[model samples]
Target: MNRIINPVIPGMAPDPSIIRVDEMYYIATSTFHWNPGIQLFQSRDLANWEQIGSALNKGEINLRGTNTPAGIWAPHLSYDAASQKYWLTFSHMVNMAGREFNADSYIMWAEDIRGPWSEPVYLTSIGFDPALYHDDDGKHYVAILEWETRTGYQAPGHIVIAELDMDTGKIIGAWHRVTKGFTTRGCAEAPQLYKRNGYYYLLLAAGGTGYAHGVEIGRSKHVFGPYEPHPSGEPIITSSPQHLFSLGDPDAGHFEMYNPNSIMQKAGHGSLVETHTGEWYIAHLMSRPLGDKLLNPLGRETSIQKMQWTEDGWLQMKDGSNVAKMETEGMAGLLGAGSVSHDVFDDFDQQKPRLHFMTPYREQQEEWVNTTERPGYLRIHGQNSLFSQVNPSIMATRATSFKYELKTHVQFHADHYSETAGMGLYYDSNNWLYVHLTYSERAERMILTVLQAKLGERMEYVHHQVPVPEQQADLKLVYNEGFADISYRFEEQMEWQVLLKAIDVSYLSDEGVNGEPGEIGGFTGLFNFIGSVDAHQHDSFADFKYYCVKNE
Candidate 1:
């Protein structure tokens, strides 16, 4: 039997919501503050997946000033057979201060997956990770986490369910409080309801989103009831199954729960799907940290597990192990067709950037970024500095592998100190490592240098500045095991000169930043970005001939 490697859809694909629409399988994952939000992928075999398109590309919502891990979360995708449409429900997290976690849920539909979706209809402000379940009777129900704010109550809140009017986007009845979590591990969220064999199964993500994360389950005869937990009294799937009882713990970074022996950690937040052949499988979020540091620069990724339903109707991993595996049994004859290439080389000859490229905190607009402005080159007008949470003119793609080479050729001229353009690695508004080109008044020429931000503190590598002779240059970054080696060369020079070598950028990982004290600093993974900053006049722009990424 062919083996399917874990992380079928890799890099920053957290909170996976998987569904099968006939023969094709689709998965939608949380995008957080990245605009063109709600990354969607389609897979034929569970082993390989391809990004088809995004759901929120039409500016349905504004994410300006959105904090890290606080924009679009937990996008649930479902197909309505009665309406013959695809339904998407997700939460827009607006605030995380004081642990209020203020969020508003919305629902939308589309006749086609890659589509002009219907305008977002307001759903509720109950909590995050809202999912829409369509029952066989044509009735619709919405299940979400009812955020608890009481001083002593269950920290992250309860999983609640209610009838919903699909046409008006209104809750038809009172919200019924179900279970806080199915197991002793707390921080339950991402509730997705499914019916199997006359049983309503409620799947939830427990033990926060860190090392202890896992998938827990409960079932009931009715849509809402006192659901019975799995008979094992534990998570059906997890990376670390050493029995953790972290009830009432709201912290998302459970670093203490890291399993040293497991190659895949933080494996949970699963979405279930049954294949056309009736084979059961689950698409879940997992992370591969760098070495033993437990620093996940790629953030949470999507993995698949072959599942087996016991005669008693309980779900379990096929091997009867709660521990997530790095490799599992793959569907026969489907492996070869599912393979996809990760290499990308965009010459900007087209009208728009590739669908895989995403911007932060703002929608992609032609006014700030366009290819027509300069034929054969993508022009991006500088807006705000990378430190700003508002608008940053950056075209970025997820860092899909630990070892990769990112290459780009850009032409930019900066007159002021605040004007700079180049490419580097980004985590959020507060953390990044940029190797940019800027004009040095003292040298009366363009200079290249490295700037880094860690925990919101800025550090400049002024010693590594290299004077450029022309307005354009070729830049490259070689990343291997959390370290970056930056190189640059002029068009005339065939050899690439190393400007910065072995720069330990491991701080760009999720565990390196500081968030709301106890919670995880960030959930989105590191991104390889080509951006420009014009804090001086917002008029400077960078024209790039091509952008390329080759994964090793």
Candidate 2:
């Protein structure tokens, strides 16, 4: 299945929440900054998932102030059979600023998938990854991993289940703390609750969300119970078929760290979905190491594998395999087609923005982004700088390829101030490189300048100017690996002149960028954007004639 089944959704699409409603399978993945947050993808055939929309597009939840590796966490998508409503539960990680671990869980229900969703109903305040359990008892329950803090003597955290009041959106009982130190890895999260035959099973992703991550299982006679970990004491599903670290970071799990003789690594934190075809598959997160050195700048993405519950009530992959590298026989031909999209191209005639987009603190306003400015072009108004968490005048799509070229044709008038708007690859506002068009003070014409920002340093990387005699110019960038060659031409120039040539872009990687300790930033891949800054009045409106990438 490894050869035929690759990650359908790539690039930081971790902590997948999947559910099958009728003939359709709807999936929601965690979005840190990418807006239209909680990207909703639907597929008739599991293999061909198309982004229907986002679960949280109303901007009811704000993630701008939410810190890196924080923001919107795991979102579980489910449908209530009794109520006939679609429900989604997710953590609004509000307080990463102090590492205070103050996050709030919210539940929203709608009659339709594309919905006028009900206002957020508060659920739990103690945990981050929250999943719902609906049993035959007609009772609703919520299971979560309550976080561990210094104030508590609980070591770190334990699994907690409580009677959930869906009507009032409250937990009716004390959080039942069960299954401690059960996972060989100290961290057990993304609990998936279910009941089969006579046992109530709780499957969890164990270890950290890293290389040694695995899937562990425990069950009880009751929802909250005297649960027992699997007797094997190792994850049922893991890439490295060894006693790897189930605890902290790789160094912490450092004891079990070794190069696995396989193509997939960091295969953990999965969600299970039972298909209408009566087959079971795991839509778990996995990473492909660029060089196997353990630095994953691309972040965890979703991969699928087939599994079955044993007679002992434990779910296992076919042939009792050690994370099968070959195709497993399960949902054969039950999948769908691969949606062929070029990594570089923005046709103004898309249903919504494609799967790769996000607004920082808020959702992109239709008022701000309108194609009505022109028939074949996109027009985005200028707002604040990209650095500010407030609404930035920017709309971007992800950089999906290892080797690709992104080009955009944007027309913007720069006024008295150094109002510049152009296109280039962006990670975060703190650290990014751009080739923007600005009005040169010395020269009367608008000139293209290389604005390379290195976070809060206030010093630009390569800020030389170029004269673009025309208002409209084509800005193109060729990112040969990390290093980039950015240039611009006004149809008058025969050749694409080199603007900022041969810049070592490895620093843009997670390990290279400037971030504090314990925080590896920007799991999301590179993105292309056209932005505007008017420190003065309203001086700029970026008219994007077209945005294309050399995805081939």
Candidate No. with top lDDT: 1
In terms of lDDT, model 1 sits at 0.91
After the best TM-score superposition of candidate 1, give how far the Cα of residue 368 lies from its true spot, in angstroms.
0.9
lDDT string, candidate 1, 1-552, tens digits: 677887887788899898899899999999999989999899878777889899999898899999877899999999999999999999999999888999999999999998778999999998899999999998999999999888978788999999999999999979999999999999999999999999999999999988999999999998887899999999999998989889999756888889999899999999999899888899899999999887899999999999999999999999998888988888755644445677778999888899889999989999999999898999999989899888898999999899999999999999988899999999998899999999898898999988999888999997899898888889999999999999999884579999989999898888877675556788889999999999998889999999999999
**Candidate 1 to native Cα RMSD, angstroms:** 1.2
What are the clashing pairs of model 2? 1-326, 1-327, 34-358, 35-358, 148-156, 185-246, 251-254, 344-549
* Candidate 2 C-alpha lDDT tens digits along 1-552: 312355666556777888888778888888876677787888776665676677778778776655455678889888889988998888887775444567899898889887877887888789788988777778888888787766534434778889888989888968988765455666777787878788888888776655566777888898888887877878777777677543433212331443467667767777778888788877777665555455554566777777887887787776677473423454655543435463646677663444455666557877777677566667777777766666677777655555677787778888754577887666666667777877777787787777666644444543477777777788888876567888777884567777777876545554445555544444554566776666567546778877777754
Report the Cα lDDT for residue 129, model 2. 83
Model 2, residue 6: distance off in Å is: 1.7
TM-score of each: 0.98, 0.91
Q: How far is candidate 2 from the true structure (C-alpha RMSD, Å)?
A: 3.0
Give the number of the best model, judged by TM-score. Answer: 1
Give the clash count for model 2: 8
- Candidate 1 segments whose C-alpha is farther than 4 A from its true place: 332-339, 516-518
